[model samples]
Target: MAYATLEALIKQYGLDAVLLVADRDQDGDIDADVVEDALTAATSEIDSYVGVKHRLPLPQVPDVLVRVCGDIALYRMSSEGGQLTEDKRQRYEDAVDYLKRVAAGTASLGLATPPEQETSGDAWFEAQPVRFGRLL
Candidate 1:
């Protein structure tokens, strides 16, 4: 499944905003093909970072990935036309920074890692009630 969908992009940034970036053909509507290409590129960029710590083609698309993908795809679309806005560039940079942290194991996707892929050793601890030194 795609990390982010066109519908989600429209919902997050509004249809007008999506059209402004994605309507490359200027057909008075969002050019879904253009959006799809941007999304595909964004997904590949994310996979490059995430694949380092997690399996490729993640079984489930995390919500955070959805937002990051949207940011990246929109930025790519805007950049292609030299219409890149400060906000779009900032969002794209933030998404990449977050992905880098995830790849470095400093952040988490909140998914349970497989036992075999877990890097830290299992830990267990037991505690006993304290004993009184003196009793009345």
Candidate 2:
């Protein structure tokens, strides 16, 4: 589920801007599904890349993520116009890089709850290669 709403996107990015980017058909009104698809794609990409597994937008999302989601939304929208500007591409790249550090345990998620570890005990032993010399 996406943490940010369309209203938030509109408010943060400007309704006219968002509508302009999202209204593919130039029908004047922003397509709700287009907005949703971009949001979903952004969330999925970020969550997966950050090792958040499969969930997105997170329940109590962090501020960085919120902004990243917005950036990703805009990035995805830019696909329609062809050729993403370096600055725009860098915006999402920076956010993804930060998340990469978080996923690597080098950085933090700030106030949001961190992604839970799902490792079981004795993973090394469990992964030991089978011996072929002697049989019981």
- The residue-by-residue lDDT of candidate 1 on 26-64, one tens digit each, is 888888889999999999999999988888778799999
Tell me, by lDDT, which candidate is best. Answer: 1
- Evaluate residue 130 in candidate 2 and report its C-alpha lDDT on the 0 to 100 scale: 72
- Lowest summed lDDT window (length 10), candidate 2: 117-126
| Residue-by-residue lDDT tens digits, candidate 2, 1-136 | 7746788788777987787778877789888898899898888877876655323445568777778888887788877646367877888788788878777767776644333443553333235687676776
State the lDDT at 5 in candidate 1: 94
TM-score of each: 0.84, 0.71
Off by over 4 Å in 2: 52-59, 111-136
Best by TM-score: 1
Scanning candidate 1 in windows of ten residues, the lowest lDDT window is 116-125
User: What would the TM-score be for candidate 1 when compared with the true structure?
Assistant: 0.84
Error of 1 at 77 (Å): 0.2
